[model samples]
Target: MRIVFIPVASPLHDEKAVQELIHQYKESVKDVDSFTHLITSEEDVQSVNIRQDDVALIGVLTGGTEHLILAIAMRVRATALLPHPTQNSLPASIEAQSRLSLSGYPSVIIKEWPPEASIRSYVKSWKVVRSLKNYVFGLLGQPSPWLVYSSGHDIEKELEERLGISFKFISLDEVYHEYGLIMDDEARELAVQITSRAVDVEVPMNEVIKSVKLYLAIRKILEREGIKAFTIRCFDIIKSLDTTACLPLALLNSEGFVAGCEGDVPALLSMVILKELTGKPGFMGNIAWVENNRFLLAHCTVPLDLPTKYKLRTHFESGRGVGISGIVEERTKVTLFRVDPLTQSMRVVKGKVISGFPQSNQHCRTQLWIESSDSIKLVTEPIGNHYVLVYGDYYEELKWVAEAMDLYLL
Candidate 1:
């Protein structure tokens, strides 16, 4: 994984404590060469010529400490990791350094973080995995909206410096203009077929041709550079095409291409992770959820090659946080939970199970009365909070799908 090591350090008093943090990450990631290091510093970083063939990535640590400046100058690169709010928990000097570095880039501000230390660690690890996947990439079609920024150079620089992946830039015009010159006859035929479908759908035949050409261009570039995996910005290009073109595009997604709609970082990340885990082409989608006092999230995993069937059932509910639920169309699974009526104590009566998928219209109801002698304590547990009864198994699959898309887990 291409991890970025940014050690939070103090700007004043010339402290070396921050450097220790960097070493800690380095120690944890034994294969340090597979990572990009950014040292936070106040001064201008020094100069060190680094070849793409030698290092997997180049990142300048920018936030606190002089060490970061030296490191940044040596590597001479800028990336998203340089702008995080790591200094929030640090001492005043380090915090001030971080504030200065993030002055202009408000979007870089940290809005969300894990509540638990363990969760934070996992999330960070996931980020590294995401970065590694995006490093080596290709452009299949037109420029994605996310790439439309101040300059094309900025995107190229980000690809080169952060991921160490060189881009084979091709404009929509060139792809439409000289597609016939493409060397691979077989690939060209496929491209032509895709282009023909694109035209039938009113997708600006020229732009479709351009996208096909771009894909061809990227294949050649990746082979020459010995790079594997890539993200193509297909949103803008696709919008130009009519709705009918969606089918072929969707089919391409199934063929192991790391594609994205708008240049969504999380989508790209999820696609890469899913490919690694399932060895299949992945597309970003949301989990189906049923609202309740507590929300439950869930999703279903179906093998592409097989015909499968399953069921779902909900046995109980929890009173503390929002209860969530999920279900899949073809598989059978059930999730159950319960809350003590008097104390509102919650428990997971059941988790994941496979049987026959639960019927969507079935309603589950349990009567409770605090005044009753036997069930008084149980009935009163949830008395203070508003009560909402939801009976369904669709929430689990939806919740999992939401998480896969990096949706907020509340």
Candidate 2:
């Protein structure tokens, strides 16, 4: 990662003192790899270029340079990091950051010279946010009919503008066309492989084979269209083919592809962010039950690699096709989060797995009882129904990414 420092100062200040302070500031970061560009006047700010993957550090050398720094930030269209070493620098940084943030730009202020480790950590988070540019995610069919708040082209556009990712909408007909081309002989081998790993298989072999064929069809589409991740209107497939997409989504997510159910773009994007930020596949599920500090998340499909043991069962609601009843280890540290494009915010909460396996069959197949102090917010101040869960505490990283993306963190 490259760190470019742009130093700005006012001519009204003592020229010699300003130059000395600028020299000391440059010397402080010399041990680390960085480039210093001195902006003595307004003209110099116009020539600055902050490219992708580059951390733009704005050095506020004087109080009168707020407008100058704002101009540079607006020109680059990137987040700004203000470092205050001199007397007036801190005050100027506060003003500049306020203006930038009010205008929907991401900016942060550093009171003093930070340690190399801290700088590296922040830079790492910045790079993760930049890496998402131009990545493509496919949405198969429309969102499930009931997801009124979770479906729309405007949501996709908002995410694309903020995160630099693309969304591809694939028709159900295309998926069915590809599903028909898969030979039964080919799908049987994969079905056998998936069934062998399960602790129990309650569904029929033919159903498992049909589900495997859907997985293959989606895989073919992903490859052909250069899509890196995807989500499907899983319930719709059961009506057309008498088979569910639960098994296919599970297989895809386990293979490190960001696959989600119900064609929920926000949930899919949240999973993509989790996968990219923390090298782990997230389990996307519905918020089935919430009571005070305890809540339940249930879904038909979970990444096959997440659960220690899993069973094959028929789809819970329709009872027509394959579903997964995965057993996650108890007391596992987890993070639950959701991205809301309408509000331009992200809701994150930290929790632990109280029960990895479900005792009741009232909800979806794979269920988890999570304990979080903020779980009640899901009922009172809900962002949406679905939230993605991953097996670790990523609150800090998520916070940083949200700030860098100019998103309100809840």
lDDT of 1 by residue, 253-336 (tens): 545555443333333434554444335554232222222222222212111211122121112221111011222332223223
| Runs of candidate 2 exceeding 4 Å displacement | 1-44, 51-55, 59-71, 82-105, 111-121
Q: Which candidate wins on TM-score? A: 2
Clashing pairs in 2: none
The local distance difference test score of each candidate is 0.33, 0.83
Deviation of model 1 at 225, angstroms: 6.1
Task: Report how far residue 149 has shifted in candidate 2, in Å.
Answer: 1.1
- Score residue 327 of candidate 2 by CA lDDT: 97
User: TM-scores of all models?
Assistant: 0.32, 0.84
